[model samples]
Structures are given as structure tokens and as C-alpha cells.
Target: MGKVYIVGAGPGDPDLITVKGLKCIEKADVILYDRLVNKELLSYAKSEADLIYCGKLPNYHTMKQETINTFLIKYAKKGKVVTRLKGGDPFVFGRGGEEAEALAKQSIPFEIIPGISAGIAAPAYAGIPVTHRDASASFAIVTGHRKEDAEEEVKWENLAKGVDTLAVYMGVSNLPYICEQLIKYGKEKSTPAAIIERGTTSMQRTVTGTLGTIVEVAKKEQIQNPSMIVIGEVVRFREKIHWFEKQAENAYPVSGVL
Candidate 1:
């Protein structure tokens, strides 16, 4: 039986992929990649490699998780090296854990190759540090996408009172709800917040505001999914250290809420 490699493709930048992740792509006989993965990275795959698209959209799935696991097992049993390339870290909201569990049940041989998650990379590219020496000392990565009835799954009170910083993924659609929860749980309405869209890529854009006005700012700016929502005092540092946007030829001016 051949081995399987679950690799994180990093955020949106092709260059952000780890060296080991790249090597997995180069050596794989079959590659299943996700939607958020940078297509440019596929260039490294061997010419004879079989490329498969497993991209998924918000509220839509192009390929089901069961099918993906089946494919991995099918390829590996055929003695073909398989690479499951996903955006950000495989285990961080990428469903890599489920895939690993599936493989484990079947006693498949596989390696986990971690990639930089957007939670940290996106904020850094936006010049918003997840943790700051003076402004922040605690950090949390949250999934903003939740079922209507599962709102209580996240500990809003602890996040508001205990955490110093929060990086929310897939949150653009639920911005208002997120802000409301934080505020309702003791977070200051004036707490700084910023959203980085398509972060780490050339098309990245950042919008800043306070918890009280971020939802409105997001609506006016028309920010969409695949964006990172950062909340903390560290957001204030963006103005002084905002470097990546400076390099983008078409970077938008940072919109701030008064």
C-alpha cells in the first residue's frame, strides 16, 4: 500500500506553502486540492500526477467528505502516493482531522504536513498581530460559521472577558451576530476590530472599526467570505506597521470608523 500525505497549502499565497508540503505535491501520484488553495502551487506537481478538484463554497459542497476519504483510500490501496492539499492548516477547520480518523480506521499509512493558518498569516499580513506584548497577551482562533441553533457552542463570555485577541474565520456572513455576542458578553463596544479580505494575496484589503460599527463598516465596504475578523487592542498597531498593503499597487485606503 502507498502512503497518504495531508498537507496544508497555507493561506492564499503560493509562496507560503511549507517546503515539506511542496515536496509532497512533487512526489504525489494523485493530488486532491481544495478551493482556497493557490492554483499556482499545482505547478510543482509531477506532469504525470492526477489532479482532482475538491473545492467547496459557502453553503455548497462540490465534493463530499465521504467521497474524498474514499478516493484517498482507493489511491493508496492501488499503491499510488496521495496528497490531500487543503488551505491553511489541515487540522484547523480544514476537516483534516476527519480524514485522518477515516484513514486511521482503515489502518492507512499517512503523514500530516502542517501549513500556516490564515488566522495568524492573514492578521500578520494586515499588520494586525494576533498577540502583542503590550496590547495583547492571549489569543483565540474561532469559527464564526455556526448553525442557527448552535450559537452557544462558543464561550462568548470567556472570549469577551478572558481572551486578549480573537481571530475569527468564515465570519463575514455572521459579522453582526459575532459583534452582538461579544458586546452582550461584556466586551466593550469600542473594542477595535478589523477585517482582512483575501488576505496574503495581491488582492488583500483591510477595513477597521470598533465592535459597535464594524457590522456597518463591513456592509458599506461589501466585504465577503474568505476574510479574517480580528478583534483586540493589537488592531491599533496596524496603522503604524501596515506594510503589506503598501506594496499592493491597487491597495484600498484603510477605512476606519470614527
Candidate 2:
């Protein structure tokens, strides 16, 4: 019987991919990938692998999600090993659950290989910690693109005010409105905030400021998506306790999680 693997490609850098995920890609006969996935990581796939783009990019959606599910089931039924290569951990805002659910109905055997989520990795690459000893103790990872925007408005506000830190994935477009909502819901204007563009890759750029100004700052800096937004007192730690500056070989975990 053929098998399917839902693999995380890490934030962007090829080397950041988990060894297990790389091995799966190397063996895959069909590779279905997301928008933000780095091409370097695709090199792990077999030379003859059927590479399919299965994401909605800036304006192009080579294959919609439902089609991707159908595509996976189709190829899997052909007794070919398939890989759904995604950016970040498949379970973390990756919509991996939906694909997995669809696969289950088709009785497709599958495995999930987790990778470093952009919610944590991007901030780390930008020298920000989701949690800090004195600054923050808890964080919420929210997707900028939610199923229900208005319904989620209050919830996002609650999270903004309640959670020690807020990391918004794919949130670059909604920054202005989100910050406005948070400020209206009693979040402090001076709350430290940052926007990291194309994190964990050579193209990574981080812009830091207060919640009140980061929107304008990011626009001025021309920071784009495929990024992470971190907002909290913990954002201040970037000045001192940073470690993931890409010294040489590996990305060392930063200190002071306590």
C-alpha cells in the first residue's frame, strides 16, 4: 500500500528541516508543497518526483486546498509515496488537520513529521522570545487569516490582552486593523512589537517598535509577508538575550526561557 507524509519544511532555510522530514521527501514519488516552502528544501525529493504547487500565493493558486486533498488521495491510490511539504509545523496553522481528515476517509496510510513552527522560529531568528521570565509567561499563535474575521475579533482581542505574548502568523496585511482592535480593547500602546519578514532564511529582516507604531514602521521599512508578528513586553529582550544570529553551523537555542 502507498503511504502519505505530511512534512514540515521549517520556516524557510533548507537545513532547518528535520532529518526525518528530509528523508521522507527524498523518498517521495509525488511532492505537494505550499507557497512559502523554500525551493532548496525541494532538492531532497527524488529527481523523478511529481512536484506540484498546492498553495494560493500572492495571486496564483496552482491548486486549491480541496484539490490538494483530492490530489493526495489520487496519487496515494496509485500506490505512490506522497509528501505534502508545508512551511512550518503541519499542525500549526498549516491546515494539515483538514488534509489528514480527508485522507482518513479514503483510508490512506500516512505519517506526520513535525518541524519548527514559524511562530517560534521566526521570532527566534529575529531575536525575540515568545515567552520570557519577567516579561511574558504565555503566548498565543493566531492566524491573520481566520475563518471568521468579525467573530474572531473579540477572541483575538481577548488573546491580545490576556496572553503575555501574541504571535500572529501570516498577519502582515492585518497589522493595522489588529493593532487598532487591541488598542481599543485596552492593550497598552507602548507594548513592544516586532515584524519579521522571510524569517529563518538569508532574506530575513526584522522591524521592532511599540504596538502603536510598528504598523507605520513596518510599512516604512517595506516589510512583507511570509513573516511572524510578535507583540508583548518580551519583545524588549531582543536588545539583550539573542542567540540565533547564524554564527556557523546550527541555530542554538536562546537562553532565559524561565
lDDT for each residue of candidate 1 in 145-192, tens digit (9 for 90 to 100)? 756555463577788889999999998998998899999988899999
Best by TM-score: 1
User: Hey, what RMSD does candidate 1 come out at?
Assistant: 3.8
Question: What would the TM-scores of all predictions be?
Answer: 0.95, 0.90
TM-score for model 1? 0.95
Error of 1 at 33 (Å): 0.2
Off by over 4 Å in 2: 58-60, 146-150, 243-258
The per-residue C-alpha lDDT of model 1 at residue 220 equals 98
Worst 10 residues of 1 by lDDT: 146-155
